[model samples]
Each structure stands twice: as C-alpha cells, then as structure tokens.
Target chain A: MQKEKPYKVKLSIMPFWSPLTPPMGIACLKSYLEQNGYSVRTKDYNAISSLFDFGGRYIALMKSYTPVDRMGNIAMVGYDVLMAHLIAYNNRDDFSLNDYHELVRQLILNNFFYEATDEAIENLCELVEQFYALLAEYLINDIKEKDFDVYGISCYSLTLGPSIFAFKFVKKYFPEVKTVMGGGIFADQFNSNSLELETFARKATYIDYFLLGEGEIILLNLLESNFKNVPRIIVSDKTVKKVCLDDIPLPDFSDFDMNSYPQLVAYSSRSCPFQCGFCSETVQWGKYRNKREEKVVFELRSLTKKYGKNIIVLTDSLLNPNIDKLADALLEVPPEERFYWDTYLRVCDMAEDMEKVKKWRKAGLYRVRLGIESGSQHVLDLMDKRITIEKIKSNLQNLADAGLKISTFWVVGFPGETKEDFHETLDLLREIKDNLYEVDPHPFYFYPSGQVDSESWEKIYGYESIYEDKYNEMLMCTYYKLNCQPCREEIYRRLELFRERCEECNIPNPYSLIDIYHADKRWKKLHKAAVPMLNDLIHSGSAIVDEYRDSIVLR
Target chain B: MEMERKGIIEVLAAIFPNQTIDIGDDDSFIDKLGMDSISFVSYVIGIESKFDIEVPDEYSLPSKLDTLNKTYDLLGRERG
Candidate 1:
C-alpha cells in the first residue's frame, strides 16, 4: 500500500538564529536526501524558538542584522556573553557561579560591553541555563518521538555554541543516534592544512562526523556508505566534485511551517563572480554558479504554487550576474504567475540597462540590496570593491526610478580611511537619500582567513598590528589595529554620526531600534543616572525588548 | 470613564476605519481585528493625536495596547 522509508535521518538547526525565513541550508539538504530516496526530517529549533516567551526576545535580536563590530551590536554582545559562560560550564565539571561571574567580568573588561553588576551576571547565568534545558527538553522530546538513525545539526557563525550544546544533548539522551555537524562555520574555520578541522573534530567528541563544504553530496555519501571508513571530518571538496546547481533538487520547504515566515527563501545562484577583499561569501561557496533560467522560473512557479507565498527572498550573493538573460527568463512567465522577489545586487552595467531593469521590475524584482561599501572612491578601491561612486549613484537613481527599493549598505572605518573619506560617505548618503529606501552602516572587520587579499590590504595600509583573543577552546576573537587615521573610537563615533546623518536625511532605518538599545547600554556605562533610566525603560514595556512577541504568532 | 472609552473607540475607528465599526472593546488588535505591526503603530499615533495625550514609546507597544479596554486603562493612568 505504501513505499517503505529507509535511512531515517533528522537534520536540525539550533536556536538563536533568524526566524524571519526558513534556513536554506537544511532545506536544501532535506530535498537532496529525499531526491536520493532517503527518508529525512528537519527540526527548525531556530524557527520554533520564536514561540517561547524568552526565546522570542533572542530571536528578535537574531533577526536584526548586526554590524561587524561586535561590541556595538547589542545582539552579538548579549549572545557572546551567554555563549562564553555556556562553553566554559560545558568544559569544566567544577565550574562555579564565581567562574561565570569572572567570565562575564572578563567580557566587560575586554570591552564587550560597558558594564554589568555581579548580581545581574549571576541572574543572567541562571536564566541561560534554564533556557538551554528548555531547548534540550524540546530537542529530546522530538528525537524520542521518532527513532531517527542520524541527527545532523547545522552550525552557522552565531549558532556554533548552541549547536555544540545541542550535540551534547543528543549524545546524552540518545547515545545511539549518530551526531553530525555542518554549515558556514566550518567553511570559515576549516583551513588549507586541515589542521584546524582535525583539532575541531578531536575536541568535539560528541559530533561523530563533520560535513564540511556543501552538505548535499557529502551527507548523502555518508548515509549511503553507512559511516564505514569515512573520515570523521568529511570535507566536501576532497570527497565529491563541485555540485552542479542545475542538477541539485529545489530546496524543500515542505518540512518547514511556511506560514510562520513572512517571505520564502530561495537562491538562484551559488556565489558572486566579483572577489571583494572584505567578503567571505566566495570563500564559503568556491566559485560562481547559477541554475539555468528555465529551472529558476520553474522553481518560482512550483514554490509559489505550493507555498502560497508570492514574496520570495533570494539569498544569492548577487542576482544580477547575468542580468539580461535572467530578466528575460523571468519575463517569459505571464504576469499572474510571476511572484515578488528581493535579492542582493551589484552596481554593474546591468543597472544602466533601463529596459532590462524595467523587465526585472515587471518580473517581480521589488527590492535590490546593494553593497555600496563606501561613498568614497579611495576606500572602495582599497577594499577591492571595483564599482565606482559615480556608477553607484547612477544605479541607485536608476533602480529607484524603476520602482525597486534600493537598500544600500556602507562600511565605516575601513583601513586607511580618513576624516575626509568618512565625510565623502556622509555626502554620498545625503546625495542618494531621496533614492535610498534603507541605509545600513556596518563597521569594517578584517577576518584574515576569510578575506581574499588581506595580505595585500595589510601591507599597503601598514596596519599597526593584529590581535587575536583566543578566549576559550571554541571561540577565537580577532581585532585589527590601524596605523593610519581613524582609530577605533573615532570609527565608533563615525558610526553614530552616520546614524545621525540618516535621521537628518529622514531615512527610515528599521535597525535604529537596536542601535538605540546599544546606546542606552553605553550611556549606562558612562553615567550613574543612566542605570535608573535603563531600568525605567526596561520596565516600561519598550518595544525594543518586547516587540519579539509581536514579530511571530505564538504556536 | 465612559467618555474615555468612547474616545478610544473613535481613535481605533479612525486608524482602522473599516475594521473598527463593529469591534468589541475586548477584541485584540492583532488577533480579532487582524492588525499588523504598522497598523498597530498607526493606532497608537491615532490615539495620541485624538486624545491630545503623549503615549510613552514603551506603552505604545501592541502587546500593551492591544484592545480598547487596555487603551482606556492606559488613558486613566495618564490622566491621573
């Protein structure tokens, strides 16, 4: 009567991730496994976390984009503080309350935040422990519900610590269930020598296997081979040929609660052709590859029909690599079948193609997120972001004219950036204020391993020194010192100034809420009066802390 | 108190003209009336303008002022 299901596996992503859309990584893996005829299930703890009263607040922070500067991000600072305590507790059996208090004290001393009292730190530690147990209860209950053979946890940059916590739960509760870990975090951490990957595997004994690079092929290989003679850390590049975008099955969102998210997530392309110096996207995805336009259109039609959501968010690096062809393919679909989409774009000759852009608009390209890294040509050149300022301005005007919302990002405090260069960025913001829908300003972070040409950038700029803080076995922090103008303090001042300029220009930055909360904490650090004021603000039922409840419907 | 309640209903009606005509005082803005985040913010602004009272940013949250009764209660505290 029914076909027998084989090779039962459950793939999950842990909490403290964005609930705005379903995770694309797990969805892709789930689809690939099903296509290969393996029974697969997904546990989206990240999405489900929004249902809890406390987890809802965390999800809200996770949903908002944080700048590269961790201290400036209320979300990042809060997450890192809790994670530092959790990791330390996990490592030591005799870890005491004082250890957590000391750990938080170290964080405060290291300039992670302005200040926190001993009592506050103690209370926060208790709350985090309770939250972890609650998350584990949910995880264990789901695992117990079905006898899954393999449990895979997808680890992103933010979810690394939580995923480790999840693996511990799986090993403790269901020891027989094989634990596997994979995602962008591995892509960032894995080095050329394989030494780092080896060290990570040895340290995380709970994770039986690590699927590096893309998961679809390696995961299927592991399942088929029955985990025999497979390396504990299976690097995708070493194991299988680069996956053809055309051959891979479309991402399966059927496993996810599609109604919970505002927009459905899909990506037509793998990576960007342009190798910007400050970018790590190309590192994660080796080379640029795209599906055939026909396949993309088909995916659109099928996904829209199945999900009943017309607004699709493409997680592609840049959707306009082959703009003309893609636009034409989308236009081939009739008006009714076409669905609304938003994607990242580069300021290339494609923007100058007014007719093609109009076709893209007609074909449901409602938003274009542009990495206008800097308004200054000098900084742009230094970052190896080839697009010129003149071109950026023209493109913004063109896209805005075509009824596409131009969400532009600017980087503050790139190496060698001067006061005048910073001013040029401000001037550009003012110039394009009318055309801009949202302006997100982020501080420049230099991840030596992640960048394409950090050596060249460092040599040319004559940076003072690079500092790496290996806080624990798991977390490694990196900080760069600029020998040239605009020190870190000045850089932060510029970030605040950038926000002020946005307000003066009347640009509606949805991220302003998080920034305001961050500023309040900074003010608390500076003034005693700010302590009472902060308490008042928190007790007043402010949306900054309480709005997470409104972001999603309670399950 | 009755007049304050009427004023709150009038403000809600102005913000969401079509939805508020037959809305019960206990109807949740989000659940019963199907108000989104933006409309909720507009309703807050509408209440502030109509009643000539400044609603604190904290109290303006949808969870805090989701119903006419809640808005009426908030007004009593503000007036006091």
Candidate 2:
C-alpha cells in the first residue's frame, strides 16, 4: 500500500445513477486501471447530483401555489424538461422529461411528486446536505490538487446512501486519501449479512478497502500490485475476484462526459441467465456470461460512436442470452444505424422468441424490461421462476406484439404466497391490463441476497425473524417470522388493498397518464389539495435518491 | 445466391465475433471490411433482410457490390 510518483487514481461516481448513466462500474474500473498500468480519473458526482437535485426540484416546483389553471404551466415545463435532460448532457443533444412528455400527464408527471412530505423529506434533507457539500468540495479539491493514491467509490444500493454521504466527507476533508468500496451495493451486501458486514464495518470505517466482488481483478490488484497479493482484496477480507470474461476491458468511457447521458450503457449479459429464486441477481456476479453478441454489437457501435448517443441502456441482467444469438446480433445492425436498445428480458426470454422477437424488433430492440415477478405459477414456483402461468401470459403478448415497449417488474409478497396466490396475481393484473406498457409494483423486499434467507426458504416456509424494517438510519429491514402459507403483513395488506383495487378497477398506472384521475372520489379530494406544492417538488428528489432505493438494489 | 447464401453468412456471423469470416466472390463490398458510413448501412440491412427483397428506390445500382457476382446480380436486379 504505497504510492508516491504520478500514481494518480480518483474514480468518484457518487450520486444516484448519475443523472442517468456514466458510472458503469466506474467505467469498467477506468478501463481496467488504464490497461493495467494505473493513472485513472473519474468523478460523475452523480453528474453533479443531477444538476443540484434536478435544479433544486425545479426551484422547489416554481413556488407551488398550486392552483393548476393549465396545471401550473404544465408542471413548470415538466421540471424544465426534467432538468434540461438532467443538465445539458454536455455528453450530446438533449431536452427530456421524455420530450415534455408530449404535454404532461404520467398522472401530471405522477402528480409532480404526489407523496413526499415530512416537509418534502426535509426539503430533500436540505438537498441532501447541498449534495454533501458538493462531494465535500470535490474531495477537498482532490486532496489538494490530485496528489493521488487511491479513492474509488461506485456503491449502488441507492448509491449506498450517496456513498455514505461521500464517505463521511472523505474522512473529514481528505484524511490522507485512500478509500475504496465497490458497486452493486457493496457486492450484494458484503458476504450476505453478518448484519450486513457489521453494518458495513461501522459505516465503512473510513473504508481503506472493501473491493469485494468483480471489481476488475480486485481493482487491478489494489491499484497495480501490493497489499499482500490481492484477489478479493477487502483489507479485512471477504474474498471475491472475477475478471476473465475474455479479458474484460473495452469500456473506458474516457473518464466520462459521454455527452452527459440518458442512454449508452453496455453489457449483453453478465450474471442472469435466470437464477430467479427471488433473485439477488447471482449475489456478486458469478455465472451466466454472454458478451459476444458480436462483442455486444461491437460495443454498441463503438460506444454509440464515442457517445454521440443513439439510445442504448443495456446493463444486462438478462438481455436475451441467445435469442438466436440476440437475433444474429441485431440482424447485423445498420437498419438506420441500429442501436436503440433498452434491455432486461426474461418473462422466459420473451417466451421463447416469437420469431426471434421479430428479429429483435428490427434490431434496435425498443424497451422491454419485464421481471413479471409473479402472476402465480404458484408464485412463480416460489420464485424459482421455472415459468408457466402460460409463459407469463404469452410473454406479455409476445413483447406487445414484438413492437416492444412493455415495462414490468412486479412482486407482491412471497413466503408461501397465497390468498389464492394473491388472486392469481390480481388475475394476472386483470389479464395483461391491456398489454401493460409499464407497471413496476413491489412489496416483498427482505434481502440478505434474496432466496429469502434460505434453508430452502426455511425448509418449506418458516423464515422466523420478523420485525426489523427501519429503512433509513443507514438501512435495516429483516422481516419474516412467518412459518406458514401467507403472511408478509397479510401479503402487505392485500398488496395495499390491491392498489385500492387497481384504483377501483380502472387499473391503470403504467406510470400514470391516467389512473382515471386517481380513480376520483372527487379528483382524489381535489388532487390532494391540488398538489400541496407537489410535495416540495417530490421530496426534493430526496437529495438525489436513497429511500428504499426502490426496494433493495440487485437489478 | 442459393438461399441468398445463408443470409450473407448471418451478416458475416454478425460482423466477425469469434471470427473465421470467409467471404469471397471477389470480396470488395466497399473494400472488404472498412465499409464505413455505418458499415454501409449495415451492408444494406444485410441486403434488405437478405433478399426478402425491397432494394428498389428505382433500382439500377452498382457503384460496387464489387462481386459474389455483384452481390448476386444486385439481388437479381433487386429481385426484378
């Protein structure tokens, strides 16, 4: 552990999916530590914590005196087109909140933050302490002008609470720079719980080393050799290595500004060729490898022509692991410079390809997502998902008739699942709620690497541990003292009274263009006092995402 | 091009992944592998889905299919 010369190593990657992309496991560990030499640098302070928590939640939702006569100037130009595509991509061309969501309504942009108060999570915890005093003034100016040693961050369990609020101000103002942590939520909650590595060794005791799983040859053997021969170099060891997927590299993202982002992410399969036992996505990337879909269409055409962008976003947990070699490599691209991706497949990989999902939808494979966690094949065979509830209703009608765009990732309590398998998953969401374009429901989230703390899920249902659920105060959620056939709080109170009986049977929520105006009881009590300043512009985006980080990270 | 010759051998086994791409018939298709302008529109979307045939935007064309008999007589005159 010694570094003096020009060994400069920085890496950063903090704030939530950094305004949408560029921290792909710290740009493949800064291209495998600059092809095994060293000198690496990356910051993406969640792209400046998504331009100051989306430009301070659109200046706290244009001073919300919410009368919405023209829905508050279309919810303040959909928060300035989602904060000018989360700040001028500086990586490419922009303008988004999905292009003024063709004039606002995914429930007026989900009622522009409909449920976020406790004074909008204390004004998103004061814009997450001014986004951790702007990552403690960029790690105290890279520890006084990059006289670097080592400092990786990458954590992803809702950016591990903004990498423990920037590893407690980089040990209170660059305490002799040397921290490190690795991604996929400290490689699936470090060695699956000893109370999550004794609460991450007492909140990452200024993390000297924790590079657990596939962190490129334990971050090129803890930054180019030293520290007693590396391999799973966790200082206080947990041991996990993984690299040779045909010698990993090709991911530089040249220290990022990849035209900022909102697309362009690669991975044509890593760990997910179906390990679905209420997946903790193969805890620390182990099996299911795929890459060569012609090297994922030549790294999506040389990283979308060096990030000019052509909409990719693959981050493969299971992107068609050989849908006829992903429709013979998206039918050899070039259908108008093909590459429009958007992955995640398994509803049994679009139920055995409807003619190679119509040549992977003319090789751009538009949006797919679908974990369809359960429509009850006895709770998808207690989540082992050997699939069959008629291949999750004929693979969501063959990926919406192979035109794609379907979105879903359902899960509603799974212990021994029953109220007749939650009324056959609300009769398979009221029989494919019109070929569902988006649903995203969740309830059962008790992970220590989900297989619900196995002993074969406690020798056929018994779990025993119930009551932990803290969720904030550095996470704590254990739950499961069941021992029976249906009890995750009576299946999370019949899935919150089955989402108020799918908004009293209007059943919409494919991300809200209409839940028939919140299935009104007088426009849901006059749009809940007409958006009380859209809950301080939706929990000031909880100073850049951490709340149940959408229920336990993995995927 | 008997079976439009295995869809140009699955677009040269998807642009040479784990190689051994044996294309011949006077190999040129824009000087063989450097056909930029996006791999010549992915080699005309592998010759319009390998002769599922649509190649006509008023046919008559051949600055170079350079040869498998000019990429099978430009797909038999864009399949007539």
Candidate 3:
C-alpha cells in the first residue's frame, strides 16, 4: 500500500460569524487532513470582515456579550435577507433591495423583530447588501491569489447564507476548485420540512459536495477516493467511516492568527448528555461523546503553550458531564502554569459538592454559565430539565461561594409557563441576584425537528407550526404561535418585565446598552416622550457592572 | 459656564429621572453622584445632544468626564 498524495486543501469560514475566537470546525478539519499527510490552509474571513468600518460596528454588537433576545433576532433577519438575495443571485434574477426592506417590514408587522425600529430595519438591509458585496470581493481576491484542489466553507447558524454566497464566488471565478460545504448547521433540523436543506438543495449546482454530520472522516474518505466516485451529498452517519472522539488528532490552530482573537477555543466533549426539550444540541449531535480526560488536559496545555493565550473558552456543551475527571486532571497542572478557562455546566448535585467545585476554581475555572431556564419546578419538569428549584438555588450559592463568576440564562416563555411561574422565575433571580455575575434573559422559540419529542410536545403544549405567510419561508427555523394564555404579545410583555426586574434588582445585564437603547427608542415611539423607567433601568444595572468592574480593577 | 452648567443639569435630570442628583461643579460622578458606567455614557450622549456637540472618542470615558467642571471644559473644547 502506498501513501496517497495529499491534496492542496483550503478551508475557510465567512462573515457574520464572530471573530472573538478562531472557529473550531475548520481547525478540526485542517488538523485531520494535515495529520493524514495533506497540505491544508485555513482562513478566517470573519476576521477580515471585522476589518471593514460598518462590519466592525456590526460585529462589535455581536461581541458585546449581548444575549440572544433582540440581537439574535436581528442576526436571524440578516441571515434570511441574505438567503433571499442568494437565491435570486443563483437564479440570475434581479433581487430588489427595497423588496428586502418591505419583507422586513412585513416581518415586523407579523410580530417578528419587534425590537427593531423602521429606521433600524432600513439600515440593516443596506448593511447586509454592503457586507455581501465586500465579502465577495475579499473572497474572490483570495481565491485568485492561491491555487487549491478543494475549497471548503464551514457554515454555522448565522454564516449559512454568507457561506454559500462565498462559495458562489469561488464556483464562478475558480471553477477548477472543488467547492465543499460542511458544518454543524447541516446536521441541524430546524423545521419538520427542513426548509434550509431544501433551499440549499435547489442551488446545489453551485456546491460540489455537501458534507453532513462530522467532516473529518467524510473528508478523508473523499480525498482518498481522489474526489471521484463520491456522492454529491455525503452523510457521515450513513457511511461506515465514522470518527471516534478519542482517536481524532488535536485541532491545529497554527493556520489561524491567534493574536487576532481574544480567547483560544477547544472542546473537551462533543454534544451534550441531557435532553432538554427546548434545546437542539442533542438533535444536531445524536449522542454525547468525550475525549479522554488526560487528552483534554494535554490539549489545553498545548494550546496555551503554542498560542501564548491565558484565556481558554471550552466549546463543550456542558462540562459537567466529565467535570470530575477533567477537573482532577487540570488540578494536576501546577497553579502557576494553569490557564484560566470557562465553559457551560449543568446545575446538578455535583455543583453542591463544595470540595469538587472549589477544586474546579483552583483548577482555573474562571466563569460558569448555567441554563437555569425557569424557577417553577413544574415548568422545569415540563422541559425535562430534571433539576429542581431547591437544587438550583443551593447549587448557585455553592458555585458562587467557591468564587466562580456565575452567568445565568432564564427562558421567559416556555410552553406551560404560567404568569405565576414567571413571577417565580423573577423571585428566583432576586434570590440569587447577589451571586449572579451576568443575567441573560431570552424568549422561548419552538423548533419542530430541533428538540426532543418536539412533535409530541407541540401536541402537549397545544401549539401548531405555521409557515408564517410567504416571507417566513426564508427563515432558518419554524414560526410558532401558542394557543393559550401568555400568547406572543403576553410573552413579550413578560420578557420586558423580566429585563426590568433584572435592572430593578441591580443585576448586571451584559447587553444593557443595546437593551436600554432599544427600549428608549420604542418608548419614545409609543408614548411620545422621554421616560424615567429607561433611566432607572440603566442607572440600577449600571451600578452592579461598575462595581463589578471596579473590583476587577482592584484585583 | 453657568448657562452650560444649568443646561447640563436639565439634560441630566431628563436622562436620570426619579433621583435627586445633587452635586457641586467639582463633585465626582462615581464617588459623589454614584453615577455608574451606563449612567455616565448616557449622560455624555445626553449632554452632547443637548449642547449640539460631539465629544471626541478619547474623552468619552467616565474618568475623563468625572466632574461637571471637567465635562464643562471638554464641552467648551469641543464647541470651540
């Protein structure tokens, strides 16, 4: 047997993706290919996008630690608008920019993007067009500068439209380059019909191969087969070539300019263990998998040494799954050599284990992010969250007492969440306000195929998935309306109340600037006057953040 | 200076309602007035809009505009 000649492979990620950290998807592919003796080059076109003036401001809002409530909705609208344009571009039909503005206005009228003003919507439409043109120019110029056998684009939730847009440029200008599209987004099933899959399939002429599931094994197989006799749609799960978590080589970040990013990223695990009904992690990744604890620690140390970064952000869905073995391994690293890291964790009895929690802090777990979700135990049980309110409160205190900065997420409108249940959530926030470092309150969304027992739960919750008129077909996820108390408007009212409660309690919201600005703008429109409620919210939330920052300065 | 100070107070009052923000010209925002970072930024934007001026990017920080006198001076420079 002879070693196959390595293909000149180049993988890239497009804009609307965050530049705060190097993407783990392409890094994994580059390492898998290079280890198998292939030449690989990777580029962070997102970092390049951030270099543009408007792009800088757009991405700064993303980087401002804003929660997904309004900001995420705005990003969703942008993604949809770009997708509409891409469809027209692929069909060689003219897409009127004003049509997109009207589409957004209709979305606004249809109870979506309610946070955006008409003026903001207009600017967002123009910005999306400008960014698409600029990114296309940058991508084409880079393709001209290099020659590669395969060009891969890693698409995520926000990057799908832009990713395909970039691939169109490559297919048009560099036809010889075998264009491949792959990412976790492909594995995500947002609706019952999988509209995104169908939409992309229509334009599949621009893409040579669409790799589903994990890319490492499928990519290796494609390269070994010399890109011949391969199916246009390669599903990793269906194929026999599957990758085990432990066997894959460490992700190579050398291709990325590590200095441009604030934190270095690595994952100790893939997928998540819990099956929360509202979450889509288990849907995208069928089951949970973890690397050996020693392997994880070794990778963290290697990344810190190689990149000279002191802050590491573990991209794991939940570190609690392997926190015991992983934290113990990390403790073995001498304190002086230990790098600070943070990750998402589940609230369970393990958090109450003061000894283990303190050991995690000693092991340099800088911040702990928890999906507290709700305060009503009934609502929590409804979501299959499995953790009790008593346990949640005690666990929050234990983690805070162990000197961990706790950032929490609260979902305002779960299916069965009553007004009393919402107040319970507010009460829970007030109870743990002293311990919380950041508060992120989000409105609930239903994805038919993205969650566990989604269909059955939809029946149980008595809600139907309607394709929200003509404009919503371009949306990545399905639109749903609850047919009970606390309808959409009620949910938004509660969401506003939730934000006001956090401000009233003086718990720092990371997105207070954007939140207050939008609130002030909306208030002026509705009431025709400047109000003190906005100021009160800001003044209260600001005190906590100012004090928090001042303590950091003192430390 | 007095007119500017009076106008600044009116703007601050509108921005930070429900509070009695008593301060001398030399009083510090953080220590004397308890103005948090968010309040400070809001105040700057408020004063800029009220005065029809734009503060330089460098002087928008709370530390640079800690005192009403300091804010007044910065506005004078920007207005010049």
Best by DockQ: 1
Judged by lDDT, which candidate is best?
Answer: 3
TM-score of each: 0.77, 0.30, 0.74
Error of 2 at A256 (Å): 14
As for candidate 2, its interface RMSD to one decimal place is: 22.8
Query: TM-score: which is higher, 1 or 3?
Result: 1
lDDT of 1 by residue, A332-446 (tens): 7764555667789999887886666666766667578999988899999988888898899888777776656667777889887889999999998888787777677776655
Query: Per-residue lDDT tens digits of candidate 2, residues A1-555?
Result: 234334667777654443445667777877777776677777776554223243435333433423333232222233333322222121121334233222222222232323333443334334444555666666676556645667778776545555655665666666766777777764443444436555556645677777655677766666555544553335212344456665676777776665434456778667775666666666666676676667767777888766656666787787655655766666666644544667777766545666656556555565678787777787777676776878778877766655455667777777777787788877778777656655656666444443434447656554554322221121322223446645544654565555654555454443211111122222223222121121121222213221221122221
TM-score of chain B of each: 0.82, 0.27, 0.87
Predictions' DockQ, in order = 0.10, 0.01, 0.06
Sort order, lDDT high to low? 3, 1, 2
Ranking by DockQ: 1, 3, 2
C-alpha positional error of residue A281 in candidate 3 after TM-score superposition, expressed in Å: 1.8
Say what the RMSD of model 1 is.
9.9
CA error at residue A440 for candidate 2, angstroms: 13
State which docking tier applies to candidate 1.
incorrect
Expressed between 0 and 1, the share of native interface contacts present in candidate 1 is 0.00
Q: What total of clashing residue pairs does each candidate reach?
A: 0, 6, 0
